[model samples]
Target: MTRHYLRNASIDQPLNVLVATPAGGTGQGGIDRIMAALKAELERRPNGVIARFAPTRGKGALALSLFHLTHFCARIAAWRLQRRLDLVHINLSSRGSTYRKIVIAACARMMRVPYVIHLHGSEFRSFWSNSSPIVDRSIHALFEKASRIIVLGTPWQAFIAERVPNAHGRIVIVPNAVEEPRVAHVGGGASVHILFLGRISDRKGVPHLVKALARMKDVPGWRATLAGDGAVDDLKSEITALGLADRVTVPGWLGPEETARLLATGDILTLPSHAENLPMSIIEAMASGLGVVATPVGAVEDIVKDGKTGLLVPPGDDSALADALSRLVQDGELRQRLGAAAQAFQRRHLSIGPYADRICAVWQDAAAAHRGEASLPALVTPTDLKA
Candidate 1:
């Protein structure tokens, strides 16, 4: 397929976009980061897209989160009355996220506003495949009503087309993007630094990562940091048991600034997860010009082309993971090449400027479709990002 870009000129009037998500600027999830970055980027640009964030979930209990959702619904009614709502862009995952967005979409439909669905859940396939028939119908209904459905990558676009055939024409692939690194990347001092950014759990393959590092204990001049929340103690214990306590640092979770500092000095970004949906960490790392070593899961293959941008190891295979890491650790030339290519890939396909352009184009299309006007030309899709 030929790569195409959206050529629509900037809107004459400000486009009011109500963004609904779990936690717009406060949450630690990938969806939150993407929304936060998009919001910040849009604010800096005069693109005429006035994005108003409406966080549906919070860090509090379920009832508290639901209360927030209730408030969001009320705001929809209020905004509609004021004639301020032009479109809604919902950032959604599976489970509770889907349920909450269902209500938000219903409210949008009731208020006669066009809304778009952006799927961000990595485990959505399992969540949908194991759901009851009634639940399946509800999900299908949600997508059926969406004016446009956005996915992180081609695989997810295919999933939506297969599951919700009627919505196939509306599906768009706009992978998550990250802002450029604020601090210049100075290669890891002395030793090769391997950084892992994400939750610390079996699902992220933390245990397997620990074992892999243990196998590479004999490989000199290398250290690792497994950063994020969840099962921190278990991971620390396993690292100690493997006698990799000296080389691996388990720093529960990092704030944005801390993570940025690490990225500035890190040489390689690693995430050996068993499941994912285009992790923001990889994008962030690539933006920092770091070589990546990750497992091929979720939409990871969409970005991390093995031997080109980064080295890929089979998930849960500690031996292969160790070998890949060792090769990168010993080959400075290969590390430089991969890191350079990964950074170039990020600039070409995942930079924030083009990402915001694509999203705004989608919002324009959705609103136009809702108003019974001809839709704008298609926006940039995954195929368009290919070199």
Candidate 2:
């Protein structure tokens, strides 16, 4: 389908966009943070876009979660009846998230409202490949119903294109972004501080991170903080067993303000995950001008260029992780160089300013496509918009 671009569309009123996600701003997950950041950025701009946070899933019992999902579907019907809804932005993940979104998308379609699906699940491929044929068809039908399918990276774009061949033309790459850190980056005084901000689980390679840090016990000038929830007790036990009890601290979880403070004070941000969909921690670290040491999983390599913006170690490689950490801790100049480059890359591409513009364009374009007004809006670059 050829998408028409409307050069001058009347935009006196803001677009009412219903964004369905796990938990908008209050949730601790990466997708929640992304939507929260986007919502906040959109609020800051008078760009004629109003996003309503319609949280479909929450950190509650199964019954409560189901209630929220049902409520979200009903709310969509109600909003459409009131003629207040312009588009439904469905933030989807793997497994249960996909199931919930299928129902939500179906409801939105029944109400004749266009919806976009933003894929954020890291283990989606594994989940989708293992699903039954009936489930696969339902998933395919969900994609077929979407106005657009937003992916975090190019690899994901390919993945979705291969799975839903007909929806290939609708796939778009919109990497996770963060607002410029309000707190400035400052070195961790004498001993370099390494920060790990995510779930404290095996998928995140936290065990490997502890083992790597243990190898650096003989080396000095480094302290680590693994600040996140999940398997916290297990991680603590491992840290003690590795004799890194004194050097490594396992704080359960940090809120946004605390996270910002930690990001500002830390010298290096590390996430040795086995899988990811462009982890947001790296983006936040880059925005804070912290040297990043992460595994090249999913779309990590898209922004974290090895030896340039950040160092990439193979997944589950304790030795390489230790080597990367030791290198950054020992060489302050290298840290500064990498941190500066990462920060520059973030400002140019991953900052919330341009991110908000691109998202707004997608929402506008999706809305237009639903109304059969014209083709997708011309996605203007930041420079192009300024000009």
Candidate 3:
């Protein structure tokens, strides 16, 4: 299905692009933001670059087996399509298979197309270290061969530089961007409505939030909304077990409009994720003028100024999470001040336009480098074609 889209995309002259991801057309969260920013640039500039989305097919009953198989197949299919693409961009995650990485990197080299790899986490310490030594070495080799690498934070930039010294110059920091809030300012009140809006997985620290809510339920009118789906039964059971059913609402799997509406109603946003690589939800909340309470992870520190734009707590520390939430829930003045600062910060730095421009620049640089090496026939620019 996606291959046909790529073939049709090739017919256009600007620059035919392919976005290989596990996410199909749904475009939720960070993936959605990326696709939207890229599409906007392609539409406005008519860069002939049409991004085609492809989802990897998983196999096996076990979660690990399914993950491995899906990554392997996705890479193989992407490797085959490298010949047709002028440049290939890979979104690297912690869960990818080593075999798939080798195959995909080899294909990029064989096709002689410049490939850009985007790093989204501190996956090296969390997942890769636990895997076999051979797998670790293979993953290192994959990072070394990339034409360019994209990172969201200084920590990742330093991590990649220290570990993969040779590839230091190729690393580009392009933080995730968020769309500006659309609705009227729907914040500032006594009864603070907090939200945790993402996958309810262990890594996300959903259980931690539940426990914190259980402790703080005695605070008058303190409520929370968990607006996503993942381990739904487990989360629900935990909430029930903790006696937080009245305080924390699990309204599962909200669509964009619903999600945005819920966010607008929220007085504050909190995400106590164990790990992250610049969560878009936090940025969206900031854009919506809501104070944030999150664990210091990924590019969060870059946006959130502790006690100013938002409050930061240590990851997995349920006590600190509860403390931060309680502080905001009790002080209306503090919440409004943080919310305003967050809104201003997001408007100044995290808007989608700048993100679009940066990504387009990266793509153009990669495309230009590929063209220079290949010495392909000069093609007309979009403006030239129009003329």
* Strongest candidate by lDDT: 1
Whose TM-score is greatest here?
1
Candidate 3 per-residue lDDT over residues 150-176, each given as its tens digit: 888777777788878998877777777
Error of 3 at 322 (Å): 1.3
What residue pairs are clashing in model 2?
Answer: 3-375, 4-375
Give one digit per residue, the lDDT tens place, for model 1 in 1-387. Answer: 111333235345667889997875654578888888888887886665678987899867777887889999898889989988899888888899988988898998999888999998989989989999988888888899999999988888888999999998899888889988978889789999999999888888888888888899899999998899999898888888888888889988888888999899899888999989899999999999898999999889999999999999999999999999999999999999999999999999998888888888788788778878777554534446553
> How many clashes show up in model 1?
1
Write out the backbone clash pairs for model 1: 228-252
Comparing 1 and 2 by lDDT, which wins? 1
Which parts of model 2 are misplaced by more than 4 Å? 1-8, 377-387
TM-scores, in order shown? 0.95, 0.94, 0.81
